[model samples]
Target: MGGCVSVSSRSTCSSRSNGERISPSCLWIDMFRRKRSRRTFSDHVTTLQHLSSIPSRIFTNGRSSSACIFTQQGRKGINQDAMIVWEDFMAEDVTFCGVFDGHGPYGHLVARKVRDTLPLKLSSFFDSFGSKQNGSGANCCNGNMKSDVADPVKETSTEDRVESLWREAFLKSYKAMDKELRSHPNLDCFCSGSTAVTVIKQGSNLFMGNIGDSRAILGSKDSNDSMVAIQLTVDLKPDLPREAERIKRCKGRVFALQDEPEVQRVWLPFDDAPGLAMARAFGDFCLKEYGVISIPEFSHRVLSDQDKFVVLASDGVWDVLSNEEVVEIVSSAPTRSSAARILVESAAREWKAKYPTSKMDDCAVVCLFLDGKMDSESDYEEQGFSSATLQSNHSGNVVESDDGQNSEPCLQRNFTVRSSEENDQYRRVPIDADVEDAENGGTEDQNWSGLEGVTRVNSLVQLPRFSEERPRP
Candidate 1:
């Protein structure tokens, strides 16, 4: 009973004074296993903690001291619109805001992916450009390795340097985003694409990068002390003289349908399919070779006290509401948090009154208030409005899905039809010939025959013969 118990050839446990003995080897092994297990559990918990902290910084629908964002699905299929406001985006003083409107099938996914990734790419490029500028006074431009301004003395003013840095970052990030979309394993972006209007606010300076029809407008008080809408980014439509010329030069057709005489769209040379309403977008590789570029139009604005707020919205809201009207609606909101929701509801109402038959397009809005001050109740009264007037009846339409994603409660529909200035442009066409006939002024009996099935269409009528050669930069 007093003998040592050998648990292993090399180790043993001495007997206690009573009668039993225990193996120290076994106890040591147990303690080591417990420590290793605890370490593994601690690592998992830290990973989960890091993940949980992320959603707080990236907000989809919420209000901050300087910003508020909201989005609603249209009658069209899924909500293809995605939005984000990343507070403290890269630094404590900087914030990133963006709204992406997806088009064609899988447009929602494309929009979401772009919303999540484009900002990261921009941040990376911005940092890289900063490092390069700090180390060697070199600048990147249009894939060129040499600096555009070779003379060091020409690089005058901090504003000019900042603008140059942001411009290069915007261009490189957009190009990288498009390339990533083309090769993405989970995404089929050959026909689907998204319109992006992104803004980075650092101190008093605002850096914007925009492509496609989605718009960013600034609300500022004019000399008259009245609010005015200053459009920051141009709506890059196919009908723009330069845009149309480029498309035509690339053998891409730019024309308006007989039914919608005003809505000029970009079409393929061989087929009457995938009529894109905008001149630029991310993805839509089918049209990339046809002069549809992803290069964003970059702009920088220094904010003043008179600059009230900035509204970045999808074309859906812009299509139905005028810029002035949107400004008025936002300014009239009872609270800053309710501004975006009210604007979207107003757009929805206008859609019903303006185009009774056409499906409402998805609307996403981000309102970034320049000043942190909230409007007093007296401000609403001065505008001759009440809080009740700005409230939206369809506010509850946006519900959290089982996947923890916010989506409108609606049955899945076919492809989407992009409409602008009261003209409908089909992004993807249905397989039905009757629908084609209807679109081409078919018999009166065929009117609205395939309109219900109208959702986002494949941007291609038929897949064109792709060349084996590498794509141009």
Candidate 2:
């Protein structure tokens, strides 16, 4: 499989004595560039300083059959949804992809941290397991056995061990990731947490770990030769029976307000401090004792030839677009690399149209090709999505039908994406305090005094009630 990775990783460097700064997500200076380069230190430093002026506005995610990823921030504000696609993640024939949606104050930071470290931890744990399994008569995955060695482990289908190993790896990696998030000296995980939906692909096997509402879905051709979208995740939302049960058993509250009665959210039992949409996640230490957990739900699958690709995305994409619409857009895109971006752009437009009074959610996605090819024909017009818009169902909830026809009241305006240049003011490195207030289910410029009655972990601040009907500033 060919990978299309466009990102070039830069080395890390200490802060210069001179007054200059870079965005936290931007390129870092290489301290050893002078040593590696035949150039002098003065020349390297000069080059580094010159590059510092450019803000990383675009992420060209893959090398170009490598897993592809693209993210677009919504008009809502700062993007807290962080996603990753790592092809050749460790050993050959392995790829790891994940989407993390952060919420509450400092959520972007939490999502970023998890995106950066979770895969590494999983790899490390797998390495340890492999070492321990070596010479134990466990002969699979090359068995690492030398010809001179006495007994070579028996050969078997790759699927057998790969799935089991990853199940353990996902469980361990999530545990270690949560511990790191909790103990980090600089990070405040008290009221913030990130939902994670991740998948590791090796050959035809896929090992998935989900903790929260971020989802993984597969677009495949079924036995009837008809295209179908299979949802790989049961979105761990508060409304799910098992999820709601666990929340209640652990003394947490799960309910919906009159304004948005269809949507249920998790609240702290004692004071309703953090009202989270998902039941499980990494971080949110404040709600840890009350029912929120960092533990992930694990699932494994064997990919068949009919499988075309898998899409992992945050709720921002799901909130606006239905499963079939998402598959239609991705399958019809001009190229696989652009599919994720197209999905995000469409979702951003829908967010504005459907929830006119509410702020949009940040969108991130990882699109992994199973059949490994991009379709040149992007004629989605015939596919029936071009004319589609958001409409109210019988329940009056905003939803776009799979067939691209609106039966109820619909928003018909074509949405314009907020340009990166126009969004520069909202993109912050260490996010502003007000951004925290806005991200944690508050209306823009929503009064902080309205939340004074609820108890919070870090401070007295409480979350303003999140309502889709509230007008955005």
Candidate 3:
């Protein structure tokens, strides 16, 4: 016979300047005392964000989380469809969790390119979010008590600032990626881009964002204190109702190409390119020009004490494993990183189960386990210089030197080099009248495209003269 179990607790109260009493909510979090599975909280605890910030600790017991990624190259034969990327960032203020899945030939290239630049972009966004949200502070005090105003205010203020930074970081990084891809000639062939689903963990807060089909799920400890699965980021596919409406606006059509329960394939340019299923992605210049919008759906949420861990996977992994099944395997593992490996392995196992003779597609999984420090032990020791730990002065620039005397402004750059043979092969003519004879030395189209990879990325070389706004440190 099942019966209801009620539990409650009392805490001290305080008063605020508004003369109202405040108290922390008495959360009736259920404890799973038995072996039963917990309820899924994907529908609840909405809103999540992702950003580049300080690194988070990897392990608690002096053991670092090991990452494992396997690429099978698939049964479809030549691994033509590439869609897997996994990056683990261990930092001070937060942990960078990212998974970028690409389609077609250039998906991997675009994913790799964006992955390296995300943190710098995030740093730029955090500065913006922090400025907007933390001004004059947020309201911290609430109901019935009046004396403990300062504590609540401090707590709320801190949380707001942290959450804001995380959210803005993601939005900015995504926008930057979109902008960067626009002018890149190397990305010309990358008409099909990638889906990125990432999360940054800071203390008890989790900031996550998703673009395209890749996903992130939170496995929370249920009422019985047993772990349960919760989806943090929504999958941005044309199959979803809201997403469908968005697609319609952009003159796109989505069709379910496969008959899988959990897996749904949607496409645009429906009559011809039915295989490009994901509605939103980075690059895919052809889609952009054809009015196929690729706006990402982002969310930001705080993980409660009940949260067990998070699982991030590509469509390759999710194609074979259901959310519940994935959660079970992941939650059973001793650590999050292990759970990530197990999830990928489970996908491979399922592929083997289905097609004993066929090879499987590339698969990747990353798990983030969130639990308090055991015995107040730190998960990671302070290591090399972290971008998050650096404090900026009143001028809003990070003073690299301890004495604030010799710090150089950080510049984001990418450089490429080519071999002499390729350079000679793609030799181009100079068009400047000042170099007349030399200008006509080569063919009309010398095809410097060969020198493309070796060229520096997006150098807006024409310098615009501007008045200096602030003094350098």
Whole-model lDDT, model 2 = 0.59
RMSD of 2: 17.5
lDDT of model 2 at residue 171?
87
For model 2, the stretches where C-alpha displacement exceeds 4 angstroms are: 1-63, 136-160, 373-473
Worst 10 residues of 3 by lDDT: 25-34
For 1-473, candidate 1 gives per-residue lDDT tens digits of 00111122222232334744433212112211211122254663454345314643443555555676778878767777887787766665578999998877667778877877787778767776665444322212212334222232332233466677788999999999999899989787877899999999875668899988788889999999999988777677775666778899999999866655455678888888678878899998888888899998787776777889999998888776778888999998877767987898898898787667677878899998876554555653353334422223244444433222444423242344444543453323332222222123432121111122232332423344467999789
User: What lDDT is reached at residue 240 by model 3?
Assistant: 48
Superpose all Cα atoms of candidate 3 onto the true structure and report the RMSD in Å to 1 decimal. 19.6
Best by TM-score: 1
Give the candidates in order of TM-score, highest first.
1, 2, 3
Using Cα atoms with residue i matched to residue i, what is each candidate's TM-score against the true structure? Answer: 0.70, 0.65, 0.57
Give stretches of model 3 more than 4 Å off.
1-91, 131-165, 256-271, 289-291, 334-337, 355-359, 372-473
Q: Per-residue lDDT for 1-473 in model 3, tens only?
A: 00111111212232346875544311100011112222233421120112212133221112133232222333332222221222233233346666666554444456555554555456446544444543232233213234443355554544454545566667777878788777766564235466777776654456677777666777777888876766565555544445555666776655432222222233345443423455578876655644444455455565556776677776666655667778899767554433454566678788677534333545556655565221111322222112212233221222223221223321221111223443343324232212112123422221111111111111111122256889879
**What do the candidate models score in CA lDDT, each in turn?**
0.67, 0.59, 0.46
The root-mean-square deviation over C-alpha atoms between each candidate and the true structure, in angstroms, is: 21.0, 17.5, 19.6
Estimate, for each residue in 1-473, the C-alpha lDDT of model 2 and write its tens digit: 01111111121111233634322111111111111223454763454333212222111232124445666655433456676766655644567888998776667668877876787678767665544444433321222324422221221222235446667888899999999899989877777788999888765567889888778889999889877887776566665555667789999988753333344567777675565666888988877877778878777776777888899988778767777788999888876656776787788778666655455666787888985553333432332222111122111222323321223421111122334443343322231134222223433321111111111111112344346886779
| Native-referenced Cα lDDT, model 3 | 0.46
The superposed Cα distance between candidate 1 and the true structure at residue 370, in angstroms, equals 0.6
